[model samples]
Target: MKNVVIAQSGGPTSVINNSLRGAIETFLSSGKIGKIYGARMGILGVLNEELVDITAQDPKQIKLLERTPSAGVIGSCRYKIKSQEDLERIVEVFKAHNVGYFLYCGGEDSMDTANKVSLLARERGLEVICVGIPKTIDNDLGGKLQEDGTFAICDHDPGYGSVARNTAINVLEANEENKASYTSDPVLVIGVMGRKMGFITASARLADPRREMPLLIILPEALSQDDYKSNLEYITEKVNEVLKAHKRCIIVIGEGVNVGDLGILKDSFGHAQFSAAEKSAEQVLANYLNGLDRKDEKGRARSRLVVSGIARYEKPGTRQRREIAYVSEVDLREAYEVGAYAAKLALNGETGYMATIRRIPGEKYQVEYSKIPLNVVANSAREFPKKWISENKVDVTDDFVKWAMPLIGGPLPEFANFKEIMAPKLCRDYIPAGLREQGA
Candidate 1:
């Protein structure tokens, strides 16, 4: 029997489980494969030889996976597998389990690891093949054409749409809060997702498709250092102008935006998650507006307002990604398909390839699955389309809406309102040394 091993790593996504389900379903339905095993917590588990034979349990566990949220089930890690020692450890585990196919699910870094394993396996004459499934909310994988500016990978990634909806609605709801509280807090500023790539940052435009909202988006790459302060000043002036007519104005700031003194979060890949643990860009802007210069055109005292980031990772950002209600059905299907593709590649004697989502040009929002060299994917970075951004660079253009609106689908996701939850493992009691040695 050709035993198969599957694992996931990096940050978790709303549909990460769907990909896992796809791979399990593929392996179970195929005769070439036998018992399916999962590394309890990704490559680290593989190195530790703590393999869980999931196939021994009822296959219905796959169903639970679809609903299961976060990386807690099989677990995931940020530990980079870059050394020869790590590679040696993986070979021993795969040999121990008679694993013929190794299916990995994660972003570019994970893919690179998978590629290395494939090379080592071939050198050692092991028959196993390795394949990667792309999963990141940042959507930093894949590339777009510099010509038409459309992404080569599917328009948006699976995880991004849900967060996009969250940001959109969060901005919409914040509008209510901003408008209502603007009298006391005249300026409403929000931080968004996007460190280097503006994918998450640009999605804020979807909140107000008409560009009617007084939204100001800032991204790391939006401008050079010299123009950043001028941009903030422009936004403050606009906030004041809007305040003249109404009590408050809604301001949207990207987490990656250079709000002078605000801080940002960098993931394992060094890409920013835009989480504000230190201080938010919104707070920075609020402080700036509050402490205006000695003199002004009208000599009106600046007013303070509210500041928040709708989807920052610093403060338990899982709720925004895991909640099923906010997930896009379109994304759900694509995620599953991508996972299935990864499994198929593992079976087809193909290795060192990522199951890439590619957008088909034309009317219907269609995608074709193809293989890209993992090395290419590792080095490349995808950003929000420049043309997609309007002149202000805060909002996405109508074309951006047309491309993204379809990816999210029309129907809202059906998630239980009360919400099922998970907690950390608790140690009930300590066992004696003798008991512990005996595997108690």
Candidate 2:
């Protein structure tokens, strides 16, 4: 009988803890395994010998983990095992604690870490079964586009659906707020989490599938900071057009959108630590647009739009990924099943594999638990399909909506609109002061 050690890495999600519960429960139910231990802060916890005996925890608390959000229970880390000394230290600690099964829950970089540990353990003569459990809101970990346009390997990540639900719901609610408040702030800019992938930002379309809302989505995949001036001008024009047509506009921008010269910090994995940046994409965009002259394409200045109330922005930051209230039932279930399946694989002496979810063909929203080689997933990334991106480059097509709709699970909240016809104005026609100044 071999003891199991599980650790979570990278950013936490609404359903990430549920995956932890799944693995823990599965291991406990299997009489073949010994005591189960959780690393306090990912690989750092193991390196520092900071192992918590999860088997000693109350069963009630374990069950409660199914609803718990984030990695608060056991905690998580961004620490990367790079040096040979760090690798050796991990093997030493596992051997000291008699840990023969290692389960890692995280994204692509975490998968690379697991693969290294598995290989290093064998080199050190330690018989360990290492498995990776997918958990990322970015949805950049694995999967390739098939000939039929469906994704192969892993369909979507566990945290992705929950965050997608969060993004969709946020947009839905923001539309209502913008509709009422557009007289003051005509543009609402929302910054979503997705380092280089647009999946999170694109999920905003799930809110208005009919394309009825006056919205613009800016993705890192669609624009780059290299041509900062050009991109900024193009985006400004789009926002102006929306405001003119609809009187209000909601813009969902990915955190990774190149806004130029943001002092960025890098994590151990060498990825840009967007959260630690001095300025966010939303702030930069809002500021830039606010300074722009409200002029028509013919170079005629307009006075109705003022710089003081041009745009208001919000960076949901971590809330986009960890908000339990927005968690999707589909995401929660898949997260748990992936973890449970990983544990089962480890118990069956399977090593160097990651538990994956494959969307069933002709699915009425069905998926099957499966496994893939850790090497295949390690250090690999999946891009948001170019075909799914609309030709205009500011929106996702119906194809993307079809692919993501099922993952969000239940029916969305319905918004109310009163189609009331207003009575004729009692006073003579009058022009607003600002518009009159512009000679309208």
Candidate 3:
């Protein structure tokens, strides 16, 4: 019996643990595998020879993983393998530990790492079967932008649906808060996690598909990078348009929007950590609207446009990806199945491949599991369809709504409201004593 090792890298999602559980359960039940180990803190754990014996854990706890959220169980890291010596050391450790099967769960960078390990093991005459499980909330994984405004290769990543649902629910809840507090805070700016991609930010539209809400979605792809002034002006213009019509506006902006310099930090993989930035996109936009730069003749900051109160900003940050309460039922199931499929591939001696989810082209929502060569998706980044960005540039098109609606699982919770019922007038309309001179 050959041993199996599983490691997770990069960020975690609400259903990421379900994928871990899926692989573990599959490997254990195969009967062909020996002790299973989880690399403590991803590839760094392998380099340091710190493998946790997962086989010794209680079956009940293992089963509970299906509901558990994030990568807290096995731990994860953003460490990138950039050296030849580190690659050799990983093979040496695997050989000494008798690790014959290696499964890596992460996004594009992790797939590249898995592909490298597979190739190195083969070159060293070691027969370790390596596989990758797709996991990323950004949904910027393998896929080609098709003319139909949909993606190919992999329809969506495991973590995206949950985060997307979280975004939709967040918008719904924020709408209620905005409706209640619009008198004091007429504009609400919400920052969602998405760097250079708008999948999560665009998901906000799912909350009000009828366009009843005064919401503006600011995608990073839709803004100008070289000109932050123009971007700010453009966003302010959009926000005022909504405020003019509805008296209250909600702006959902991507973290990577080119509003201004955020002084964002970078990870080992070279991706920007917008959450750790000195300032957030929403905060910047809010400050701009609140008159951070524009001033009156006396040098006093100008008030917000056509509104009584200032704009307030909120950043959901990592909660958008790891909140257990918002996990989509569809996403949870798919995460598990994709993981189990990867284990099955490894058991069948498949190498240099990653498990993938593909959508079936039909009216009914359906998907099939398959494998794609790791090299094909190793460093691939899917671009959100430009055609899907509405002509106004502040919203996503209906075509995108049709393509993404099913992935979020089921209908969101509906809130009730009382219809306007006015009583008989007590007296003729008259201006208030305080506002008579100013308004009447």
Best candidate (score: TM-score): 3
**Whole-structure CA lDDT of model 2:** 0.88
Misplaced by over 4 Å in model 2 are 292-309, 431-440
Query: In model 2, what is the error at residue 85, expressed in angstroms?
Result: 1.3
TM-score of 2: 0.94
Each prediction's whole-model lDDT (CA):
0.70, 0.88, 0.92
- Rank all candidate structures by their TM-score, best first, as comma-separated numbers: 3, 2, 1
Each candidate structure's TM-score, on Cα atoms with residue i matched to residue i, is: 0.83, 0.94, 0.97
Residue 385 in model 2: lDDT:
91
Q: Each candidate: RMSD to true structure?
A: 14.8, 3.1, 1.6
Candidate 1: tens digits of C-alpha lDDT, residues 1-440: 77988888887887888988888888778777987888888888898888888788776777887767666778887667768988988998899889998988887778778888888998889888888888877777777754543577544566777677766767777766665565345565666655556666666677777776666655556655556687667666666665656555666665556666555666656655545347766666656676543335788534332321121111224466666766777778888888888888877878878887878777777788877777777646676666776786545678877777776656333322334476766978677775556353
lDDT of 2 by residue, 1-440 (tens): 78999999999999998899899999988888898999998888899999989999999999998888999888899987779999988998888888899999999889999999999988878999999999899999887777654677688999999999999999999999998988778889999989889999999999999999999998898975488777777788888788778877899998888878778899878998888999998988887777645667986544333322568899888888888988899999999999999999999999999999988767466789999899999989999998888877789989889889988879889988999789988998898888666455
True-vs-predicted CA distance for residue 341, candidate 3, Å? 0.2
Model 1 ranges off by over 4 Å? 146-149, 225-228, 244-246, 261-276, 292-318, 411-440
